[model samples]
Target: MATLRVGRSVARWRVWSTSASVVVTEPDTLAVAREVVDAELSAVDRACSRFRADAELALAERAGRPVTVSPLLAELVGAALAAAERSGGDVDPTLGNDLARLGYDRDIAEVRPDGPAVPPVRRVTSWQDVSLAGRTLTVPPGVRLDLGATAKALTADRCAELVNERLGTGVLVELGGDIATAGPGPAGGWLIHVRDRPADPPATVRVTAGTAMATSSTASRSWRRGGRLLHHVLDPRTGMPSSRVWRSVSVCADRCVIANTHSTAALVRGAGAVTPLARAGVAARLVDNQGQVHVLGGWPS
Candidate 1:
């Protein structure tokens, strides 16, 4: 289903570069919101992109020493590390090389068209290998850092905060499948539709103000490598695509970062995710490989 936008006088901008959509409830503040949203994502990409040669993460890869990074990068690195710890290493920040070795060196959309073969590679660098002290970060010499799992979510959270607090209006920002809202929502709250695949039936739900939602899916961003199916979501332990027991997982939390962390970790954890998600008190929905659905932590059926 196409992304549905609600509310009156909202300016909607879709950024394909980041697969993001900026929706501001107050039409008058849309310009400011879009500017802030774009700036935030651009800054994040410049600071954290693994594909850019001049990105901070890229510079940290070759510095072979403590590299001074911007405060934003430092904060995001800390968030990624914390997410890794919270997810029990299920969502790692140091799998850049592991993913690259698996032939996911480029964006998943680009990698999917060729259907190249990639062999299973074991995770070599753990989050522990990347050391951060305030704004200084030290990565293992020759190792690459990929914050893809966490940076986007952090961007949404930051964008929402900036837009809401600065503009004094309610705003919703979605970076791909992760959605976050700030300030007071519309009368009935913000309505969002969730589905594992584009063709799948959607389940629409309204989020209260300040709520965030995220979905991680294996159904998308998949390719065939070495005659084997490969996906963007990888188990850091084996550096292989998850076994695909669960096709997708969606979670709602107070913050987009936490929600995204939970959803991505659920995809990596497969069938075992239910217990941990319940324990975390997250409202979530999981769809299995066989198309079975499971709801946990009071997720709406």
Candidate 2:
């Protein structure tokens, strides 16, 4: 883990193949804040990791019948299902098998950059097929659950809220660019440098306390297989990687999960995303495949 002191103390580490950063307004609370983030991250990884064979999700998938799960997993799954509904199936959690067939069965870092041709697998089951009653979850016979889309953002939201509640200090938790904050912010506000790719122009925006931001990118978590470039954001309809109409989409909302849901959906929606995103009434910035930037719903220019 790396730590930086700039009025506040920030700790950075790697988890679940992505970077995690935690910042606290009160420097003295930094250690305790880091502890809270670490504990929560570990818990989330255990509950929702798609790559871990011993994770709760794996066990539930292997059972083939309804199985009781932890409240955390239930909440995670619930959020994912809600996202799928909100996006009209553009953001789906039941594409796990489709993703695997396209060469994303393991951690992104472990995925082979070049592999044999694998045809796109049609979705046999949609998010509607998965059932969650109380804590019991049921995955259909051939369906697999993938929580990658929403679980990380939910963890960020959870960690920030938990840190602020327990430590009584303003905290910002960023997991792979899905950011959430709570408590009182620093002077002015929390300044976030928003950019999807390293070469893209950056914009610094201030977010007040208790708000969240999430960025979904086709540029990241991508690989080449059989001469075709593939990314993680899949269209549930075709069970294939979405065409790169937009390289990335960033959105701001009151909650990280909501913001992430919209951003990921925008990628799947492609050029047609503007009208729907505009209707949703959230501030968003979209970077197209040609690097043209489009701002909507009062997103700063």
Candidate 3:
């Protein structure tokens, strides 16, 4: 008898990034796949989201004093600190309080600009200020850990890994537009959409094998505050929203966690970091605020 191959059809389910559709030949049950995606997204929300007060990250943020933490939290903070170093403090994880001081304490949906307020209001700087010894991460007397960049990607990467290990099949995990995939996809590659803004057209990135692609853009996650447009991607060097360098940067690499780290760092560093990224052998595409597209590194021209 021929190999008993269970015929399967494609099914889509929405969760983190609009929706995800997968076609599997081995898995005959649609309900099982949907359940896997649902469970994975729920884990991401519980571990890394800033909106939920009951999230693990929220608990860590409110730890107040030096306290022992789980390996997952430690991994997120460590990756964030490393990114801060790599970006030369351009991607600090200790800027949560600073973001709140600038009127982004709530979701961007509720934000509205008042009028011209201050030109150069400094917020927080230096992830070096957050000290982690063993499992106890000691935040400097008044500092707070924001791991917004790192935690989201970390959750994405982990969720992808979990599905692959448990289900023994291919998986694609996405948070917003950031994505991580494991095993093999339908076409032997994972197809991703890279959008400059919410309204702009999406460009495709074909990823093969175990890979991660992350994009950081200032379009959807920003609002006008004090007569100024402000976004969440804070520059640790200036302690404010990045100004008119690049509108967005999308990176494809081995890990979503590291890809997010680099993409956010590159945005903060502006156009200056393009050469370094190219030299480091990373794929990146940048869209400037003026609508100019810059394809650097391994990104297709």
- What are the lDDT scores of the predictions, listed in order? 0.81, 0.88, 0.69
Taking all chains together, the TM-score of candidate 2 against the true structure is 0.96
Give lDDT tens digits, candidate 3, residues 1-301: 0011124544555554344444333365345655676776686567656567887767766776777766766777788888888777878888877777776665555645543453555554478878777677766666666777877777667766766766667766666666777766656465555775665545766667677878887765776656677888887766788765887888878998888888888878876868767876898888887776777666842
Instruction: Tell me the RMSD of model 2 versus the true structure.
Output: 2.0
Number of clashing residue pairs, candidate 3: 0
Q: Higher-TM-score candidate among 1 and 3?
A: 1
Task: Give a tens-digit lDDT track for model 1, residues 71-106.
Answer: 999989999999999999999988888778877787
Model 2's alpha-carbon lDDT is: 0.88
Tell how far residue 238 is off in model 1, in angstroms: 0.4
lDDT score, candidate 1, position 166: 91
lDDT of 3: 0.69
Off-target runs (Cα >4 Å) in candidate 2 are: 1-8
